[model samples]
Target: MRVLLIGEYNRSHFFLKEGLQELGHEVTVIGLNDGFKKVAVDISLDQNYTSGIKKKIKVLLHKLFNIDLHSKSIKKQILKNQSQLKGYDIVQFINESSFLCTPKIECEIFDLIKSWNNKVFLLSCGTDYISIKYAYDKIPKYSLLTPYFEGKGSKNNYQAPLKYLQEDFKKLHKHIYKNIAGVIASDLDYHLPLKNHPKYLGLAPNPVKILPPNPIKEIKGKIIIFHGINLYNYYKKGNDIFEKALEILQKKHKNNISIITVKNIPYNEYIKSFDAAHILLDQVYSYDQGFNALEAMAKGKVVFTGAETEWLSLHNLKEDTVAINAIPDPQQIAKKLEWLILNPDKIIAISNKAQEHVIKNHNYIKSAHKYIDLWNSAN
Candidate 1:
């Protein structure tokens, strides 16, 4: 099989491509820089519009003429590479707005892909029309929108997600669904929203490249807690909640723990930034681990992320054994951290379990086989 993965989130498609290649399937990934994360792709779509006078011009044009210069550059890149993007047995989009373009432009890109590919599919791994609508209607008990509902973000900061609620995006959603083979969710957050839909494929857990186990050594003195932040997603990822929890924990146990916080770095650097960490504070609002959390867990770090009832039930695992379920409450997060600080042994045990769990369930090749089964079955 030949597969083309359009766009990426935390190098998700890159790893997926590697797994597929090992299984004797040809795969390619086309993706952007993902801003500061600088996620790699097989074919680069980055247009160097992120910084410098170009960015200022981009902003000015948008403000004055309703023109999106950056997006326009992206559209040009896509067209120039359209030939390289086609002729795949299967084509999968990483999101509804795979190109991060205006909705109308996405339709144009979709039409091009639709005409060229055998079976085009969608991946519900990020903010999209259906998922946003589902959360907007309060379908889940709590979601990334929890902060939004509590009125936390400014409109300009939320334009990416909030735009999914607009009519243009709705039409783009319909346009894709009307023609695509099916859609798959990378985790429970997206899976729940897509469940029972006619075009919905089952959830495929995010794949992680299992890391080599560290030699057994007892965690020393002050516990190291690593927190990485992406400013754009601060509110949605509940970074504010995590920050507040850190403040409380620091105030109470200043001498017991050390905190390292890095902001908006490249993907590789961000991963390396937390190497000494015994505990990784991942997102607060999620129903399953994001790519970062899973990778951290694979490295035998106890990760504070989504391991909720649905996730627990799906895996038939108990709470806090693999990863901590981080809710929206700062006080609750502080309490969880306090317990971990007190019980270093428990952290070690959970750390071991977390790595084992990811190896068994989320190994890239293991996940690739699952994707193969689903795609072939659909055919």
Candidate 2:
């Protein structure tokens, strides 16, 4: 089978491509570098002219005349690449608004792709109108929108959810959901909201390349806990909570624990810097783990991330023995950190379980087969 996976989220399509190829299927991916993460793709759609003076001018034009120069550029790029995008056995969009442009432009691109292939699946890997609406309306406790509901909506992270609630995004979401072959969730966060849809497919774990188990490093001195922060998503990812907890933990066990926080670094450098850390602090707002947490877990690192009951139930896991379930409470997070600091033996044990879990559940080959089954069934 030949598959065309469109858009990139944390190098997901890249890993899926690798797995599909290994399973004797041809796959091609087209996506942007996705900012500093620098995810690889076969056909790069990154707009080089959207920065500096050009960006300022574009913003001004959009403000004054309602002209979206960025969307115009993306539309042109899609038209130019239309020929190469066709003839695939299946095409999977990363989200409803996969092209990162206006909804109208996304519909245009989707119409073109749909005309070429009928088996197009939408992956619920990130925020979308349906999921955002569900989150805001249902207001699930300790979700990504928890901060927004709890009177901490000063950050820009809520902007996307707000925009998704608008009419234009609603139209796009309805159009795509109604026309697509099916929708699949990459985790419990997306799956829970999408599971009842008529065209909903089953959940597929995010694909991660399994690395050889690294020898457990002895905690000779201070334990190293690493947290990478993206300034734009700081509040959304609950970095402030993590930092506050870190400060408390540091004050209590200054000599025993060493906390390293890096802000807004490139993906390569970010991964390299955290390679030797004893534990990685990932997001606290999510109900399911994101790509960063899974990658860190794949490296045999004890990751403090979302392992909520919903996720546990989805995976049929009986206990919270894998990753630590991080909530929005700083005191609870500090307690987890303090416990890890005191019980060094448990860190090694959890690290081993983390790697084993990733290998068994999220390996690229196994995930690729799941995708194959979904696509075939949809067809």
Candidate 3:
């Protein structure tokens, strides 16, 4: 199979590309570096409108004409690479807005891709029309939208996901579902909302490249807790909740625990920055681990993120055995942190289980085959 993954999400497509290559499939990934994380791609769709005079004009254009220079620049990049993008056996979009364009533009690009590709699929991995509507409707017990529902849905912080609610984006959503051969979710957060759709192909757990478990670093001196925040997603990802919990822990266990916090760093630096940490505080409002959280778990760090009932049932695991289920309460999170601080043995046990969990459920090769099976079935 010659497969083309159309976007990058936390290196999800790159890892999948590696696995497909291992399986003797020719795969190409074409997308941005996923913002500041700078994940690699075979073809770059970078828009150089970020700083200096270009940025000022971008803002001025938007203010005067409601025009997004990003949308225009990305479309031009697609045209420049249109030749390389043709003739794939399978072409999968990483999200509904794969090119991060307006709905009309996305539809145009969809038409272009469909004209050249044999089959097109959609991966409901990031915030999209269906998942956001489902979450805003309160379908899940809790989701990334929980904070938004609680009066924190600021236009500035949540503009990306909120745009899905508009009529233009709604039209784009329908057009995608009508054209794509099938849609597959990367994890349970996305899976639950699309479970009953006729074209839904079930969940393929997010693929993480599983390497030999790094020897569990001995917790020397004080327990290190790492929290990396992206300001744009701080509210949407429930980072505020994590920060509040950390505050309580810092004061309560000041002598026994050391806290490290960072904001909006590159992906390479963000991942490497947590190497010495004993525990990683991931987001508080997900039904499953996001890409960063899963990567942290694969590194054998006890992650404080979603290991909810749905996830536990899916994997048939006990609570707090693999990763701690982080609820949206500071007191509760602090309690969980206190327990881990007092029980270093529990942290080690969970760390070991975390690595094992990723090995069994999220190995890149296994995940790639899962995608291949679904693609074949759809065909």
Candidate 2 ranges beyond 4 A from true positions: 153-155, 215-217, 318-320
**Candidate 3 at 42: error in angstroms?**
0.9
lDDT by residue for model 3 (227-312), tens: 98988899877889988898898888999998899999988899899988989998888889989998999999999998899999
Q: Quote model 3's TM-score.
A: 0.97
Better candidate by lDDT, 2 or 3 = 3
Question: All candidates' lDDT scores?
Answer: 0.88, 0.85, 0.89
Please identify model 3 stretches exceeding 4 Å from their true place.
Answer: 215-217
The local distance difference test score of model 3 is: 0.89
In terms of TM-score, which candidate is strongest?
A: 3
Model 1, CA-based lDDT: 0.88
* TM-scores of all predicted structures: 0.96, 0.97, 0.97
Question: Regarding TM-score, does 1 or 3 come out ahead?
Answer: 3
lDDT for each residue of candidate 1 in 133-244, tens digit (9 for 90 to 100): 8888998888878788898978766788889999989999999999888899999999998889999878887888777876225887899999999998999888999999
75-165: candidate 2 lDDT, tens digit per residue: 7887798888888888999988777788888888888888887588999988898788888886577577877777774747688666778
